[model samples]
Target chain A: MEFNSRIPIYLQVIDTIKKQLVTGKIPPGNKLPSTRELAVEYNINPNTAARIYKEMELMDICYTKRGLGTFATQSEERVGEMKKDITMEVISQFVNQMEELGYTSDDMVKEIRKRSKR
Target chain B: MKYLQTENLTKKFGSTVAVDGVNVVLEKGKIYGLLGPNGSGKSTFMKMVAGLFHPTSGNMMVQGNKLSILSKGEIAFMPTEAYFYNYMKVRTVGEFHEDFYEDFDTAKYEELIKDMNLDMNMKVSALSSGMAAKLKLAATMARDAKLFMLDEPLNGIDLIARDQIMSAIIKKASEDNIMLLSSHLIDVLENILDEVIFIKEGKIVLSGDAEEIREEKGKSIVDLYKEVFAS
Candidate 1:
């Protein structure tokens, strides 16, 4: 995945995984790749991969089974919440950018609706 | 767990000091990026830790023991320059490393060589600069050392080859060892660094967790490197 150099890499990876989980790319209760595997896959530091798993565990997005491996949360509600969180985040960023360009909320809604029809 | 610690590590060449009273602690289970411009003492500092050059003063401890012959066995160093004989074939080089270091794993060497797409029959002199760099990395990483110090492993390598090299380095990283890579290519190395040490004029100017530094400065490590070294 392409990363923003300005942001922390681990946070970026975490967000990517969250988006995947929300989209069912990583299905509920599915096993996550081992930390080393994640590191290799993303070309990131192994330590950062470990931290990603740890942070996800703490956030209830994933859980680790002793001697098995980490798995995505099976709760549909949690996944649904994550989807909403991501959608809001993207919308807010887009809105902020449009506002910076002097576009009003009405203009944004009108433009978005016009584009949706196309 | 501090795997490697240096206290007032200093090295000098005649009247000029290459590494000035620098104190640093490196822990296991992490990869550290030593970032600096040319002639910033990055190589000098790594050479001292590798035992190729003795510290003019100060003490270095590796895995709780003073830097000595025993510690040397646990440290694998890949210098910036090609150290192999031009006459030697790639296979001979692997055999050579196996003969010298007890930690060198011949099987691992073969695997790495194959992964890097280097032919065993190819002569060292026949390889391109990029291929030579890959060969050096494969040879050095074949050893299961406690500390791996690679001086500019990414230098002279192409983008695709760089990804291969990075994957190899990532595979070698484990909880029981510390990997220290020195490279001025901050953008390339930033993602894989657990911590970053910015060196200037033989001294560490800034050092901290890579992510924390980004969060604190609100800039990328590349930007930070430029800012730190800018006159």
Candidate 2:
């Protein structure tokens, strides 16, 4: 992954996992890559890689199966919640970026609707 | 416990100071980058850690023990120089390491040599600089040491060979071992490093989690390296 220098790396990693979860790229009940494998893939510390799973567990997005491995939550309710969270995240970022460009809320809504209409 | 710790580590040659008052802590399970310009005391610091050169002052601890014979065995130092015998074939170097280091794995060395596409029958002196580096890295990494210090492993390696060497390093890395690599190739090494230590005049000017440093500075490692070395 091409990491952004702006955000914390773990956040970037979380976002990627959340993206996959919401999009069903990694469907429910799927096992995540082992912590060691994840570390190698991202070229990060194993401790940092473990943090990724810990955060995911705290968010109820995945659960550990003892010796088996960590698997994505099979609950549809949590998946729905994750989808809403992702949507809100994108919306806030868009709004904040528009605000940076000196565009007001009304201007943003108008432009967004105009663009969606076409 | 710190995997490696140096308190006021200093090294001098006669009246000239090569390393001075460098204090740094390293932990296992992390890949660290040792960054500095030439003559910034990077090599001197590494040599001190490797036990190749005695420190003029200060103390260093490896695995909770002071620098001693025990620590030396667990620390694999790949020096910048191509030290292989001129008549020794590439495979002969692996044999030499196997006999010298108790932890050296001849099988892994053979695997690495093949993966590196090195001709085992070729004489050491006939190999190119890049191949020689790969051989050095392969030999050093084949050992299951507690610490692996690679000094300029990718110095003159081409792009493709750099990738191969990097993958091998990543594969060899585990939660039980620490790899400290020195390189001027910040862009290539940054992504793989867990932490980055920037040295200037033998002191650590900046060091932190690689990604954390980027977030804190709002610049890539390459940019940070340039900004630190500049001026």
Could you give candidate 2's per-residue lDDT for residues A21-77 as a string of tens digits? 889999998989988777667765566778899998999989999999989999988
RMSD of each candidate relative to the true structure: 2.0, 3.4
Q: Cα lDDT of model 2 overall?
A: 0.87
lDDT of 2 at B81: 90
lDDT of candidate 2 over B104-126, digit per residue (tens) = 99888899899899977888989
Taken over the whole model, the C-alpha lDDT of each candidate is 0.93, 0.87
Q: What is the lDDT of residue B109 in candidate 1?
A: 94
Give the per-residue lDDT digits (tens) of candidate 1, residues A25-92: 99999999999999999999998999999999999999999999999999999999999999999999
TM-score of 2: 0.84
Quality class of the docking in candidate 1, CAPRI style: high
Best-fitting candidate, measured by DockQ? 1
lDDT for B227 (candidate 2): 92
- How well does each candidate reproduce the native contacts, as fnat? 0.94, 0.50
Q: What lDDT tens digits, residue by residue, belong to model 1 across residues B15-63?
A: 9999999999999988999989999999999999988788999999877
Query: TM-score of each candidate?
Result: 0.93, 0.84
